[model samples]
Target chain A: MAEHSVTAAALTARHQTAGSAASVRRLPGFGWSVGLIVPIMVLLLWQLAAGGAWIEADLLPSPATIAQTFWAMVQDGSLANDILVTVYRLALGFVLGTAAGTVAGLLTGALPLARRLLDPTLQALRSVPSLAWVPLFILWFGIYDTSKVILIAVGVFFPVYLNLMAAIAGVDRKLIEVGRVHDYGKLRLMLRIQLPAAMPLYLTGIRGGLGLGWMFIASAEMMGANNGLGFILTNGEEIGRPDQIIVAILAFAVLGKSTDWLLARTAERLTDWQDKLHPETGA
Target chain B: MTRRLDISDLTKAFGAAPPVLGPLSLTLDGEGITAIIGRSGSGKSTFLRCLSGLETPTRGTAMLGGKPIRPAEVGFVFQEPRLMPWLSVRRNIAFGLSHLPKPERARAVEAAMALVGLSAAADYLPKQLSGGMAQRVALARALAPRPDLLLLDEPLSALDPLTRERMQDHILHVAQHIRVTILLITHDMDEALALANRVIVLRGPPGRIVLDVTIPEHDPAYAFPRDRTSAAFQAMRRRLIDALEPAPVALAR
Candidate 1:
């Protein structure tokens, strides 16, 4: 009986440890597993295709060659500087675009007169591609960080604006009626009910907007910029370093995805119960 | 002083159709449960909407509490719970009382939950609830404000038979305990007879009242039929069925 009790206690302890561990295993916990698999798969596929005579070696270098080139570039410190520059541009543009777009979208969506007056003009502006604005931004702000940042901001603006407008427009009419029934004043209604209700859509827009901002910054920098990943790629072309160019492209893609993942985690924490089954990301 | 409701020649139309309710007059005395019964598309719900200020009368006047009735003062339970997807059951109950102080609001929420037997599921979200539970939460929400008049538009038309009977009993218990007046709209004649002191029937597009029967018994238990096997209960049921049947056939009889 005593042995049985001891074994039972041991089993209980193991079960408790397993349960706690299970609870601790959330979405981000799986990120490392994903991270480990993707690069390994890419490397294995690339090495097989290139080294096994599937593709021309000159066009698609072996994975070993690419790794050697990446190590050399890292040791030289140029790649690190380029990454820093690109990140800085993304941060500035995203902040400016999101703040301006959200405010403008809310105002336009809420007021009929404002929507009628501004919607046409904004619609026309949104059609102008992010690349199309490059020349104008260069003329307006010069071939510097300012011009690249402006281009990125313009790229981020349309998606966030459209989403915010939709979110504001979609605030439930029944809930607004409830607010009126409670005799809640205008400020209270907007702040407490309308804004919180619109949060899921707004955060989703912010995520897409940030991704677009990062994408535009790299492209804008490629067109004309003193420093950034785009500059590194341009220099690569000048020096015939195709490997560096490919690495920069890979780094940009990875960066965009990581930033979006971080934003999604933040959204999950903030709006835990708001949109329990949001159509997008299903978080 | 308790106020009376006077609806005079109330007419309402939608789109290109003729008026749903027209030239109909109703004067409701101080406080009691009045059930409006009719077949589907008989404009019974529309009449309830007009009374609740969800729809305005095109060419008539509806005065309540000796003044023009405002939507805010009349609490309405929609066909569905229509609870905010994000709010908890308790929050939905207190939604209409947001302006109240935190403590008083909490107490009111607890009281309303107790009334609807949803005190244990107060923290559950609307989607987490069963259909009957969600409707119960909706009832608790409507009742929290202690409105002078509560308007329910087929609030229990979705529940199962067993649940519906229980809810009918619950409604009766609440009407007996509270001073609030209720205007219930339903197509179920049995439900109308079970809970209402006075029953009004509406018929057709330009909906008009066809029958108005005041039950003899005031007691909640067996309010419709003191004993289902009794002659009085059977007679009342037959009369109500005849009243609901085609007017031409009833006239021939």
Candidate 2:
């Protein structure tokens, strides 16, 4: 053992990354610019058709009419309140679902016994449509924010849970061997290697869960809700306001895209060092 | 520094499968490079795994300097770099040096990087590095802790021929400068002759050391090189190839 304390200058070879191009190629601002073309074209065609009376404004309001209704709602501050209510509920549910799912995921992924006992039950529950719980939840927790939030949370939880479980369980064996070789304790191994390894997939799960949260809105806001984008959608149906309906739908679309964009950007920041062929755009 | 590794009848079997490795024994004397050359299924990797405590041996005791071999005292370099994608080269090298203070750990990382000629790329992530550079980072990471023994499990098997040759020279250089003991497992006969002084040929149904020869001339880092380079290389190659030849029958099952 005395002789093993030798100098560590075991090598003297210079190497650089200069030879390999970044496998992930990015052309600044170009992807979004091109992506906007098709949607813009669709909007233009819709407006032309509506103006020429090629379609009835009763069923499919002109883009112009939709924009006017949108502007009026904005001025009245009602749109703002609806938007805020929807976003607040979605965010609250997303956080709650993410926290619970992450804990459950870590348990099942790390422990065989936990996985055997819990996974089958969770998977079966996931198969039950979140909206299917509407009647039961209203009876148990009532139509207050409690029922609505849990309904949204239930929608969000499954994807997040599954992704986290798969991420932790599927970390590369070769990579795990590196941790073992270091004689790392289990906690250190999980924190230093396993957590970081699980991040990319976990982020994907959160993004999917957020999308599911929006899907849950139609069901969650169907009960005793006075104000929200969902309320506007239902209210439009009762009053025969196609323009209002279109406004609500367009708002949901915009909100979903923007939120997903924010999440994708965060994912990019967290996984920049990943050695993978990145998606061509910030999708 | 170097460590003398003593093995007495080490055997490993996964579940009920036939034993992949030994019920064999040998001693690796301290302070030198030993190369274990074998065929793919001959269990060269299993032997190293047992010593590094990655796999538990079904039978045997392996000791380092009259004590049980500790996992912390083993520096392992696998066939692939197996680096953490999230870590920069410097942080990866600093990984095993966690017991040290931050400043000391940083210094140790710098030293290991300097040793591996990777100082310039310390800030680079694994993805930014070329294959050879990644392997060097792996080597630096292992050496940063200044372990009692270095285990190379086909460490150069993934590199191109030119890069592999350069790494051979790097190993020779390391053996010359450091007092550390190295156990290099490879199927490459030329590689075995290029750096190691002690060459052990492993053969199987149950892999065990079949030939253990101390070719003192092969450590060209210490001796005259040109004359011995070809003649001695050829001689050792023949000797290893002969040991690897198919035999008719075993003494008993």
Highest lDDT: give the candidate number: 2
**lDDT for predicted candidate 2 compared with the true structure:** 0.84
User: Which candidate tops TM-score?
Assistant: 2
Q: State how far residue B214 of model 1 sits from its true place (Å).
A: 1.4
| Positional deviation of residue A44's Cα in model 1 after best superposition, in angstroms | 1.5
Stretches of candidate 2 off by over 4 Å are A1-30, A280-283, B217-229, B246-253
Residue pairs with clashing backbones, model 2: A3-B1, A3-B2, A4-B1, A4-B2, A5-B1, A6-B1, A11-B115, B1-B179
lDDT of 1 at A162: 81
lDDT of 1 at A33: 73
Q: For all candidates, state DockQ relative to the true structure.
A: 0.15, 0.39
Q: How well is each residue in A238-271 modelled by candidate 1, as lDDT tens digits? A: 8887788888888887888888888888887767
Candidate 2 C-alpha lDDT tens digits along A137-174: 88999877777888888888888889999998898998
TM-score of 1: 0.85
Each candidate's TM vs. the true structure?
Answer: 0.85, 0.92
lDDT (0 to 1) per candidate: 0.78, 0.84
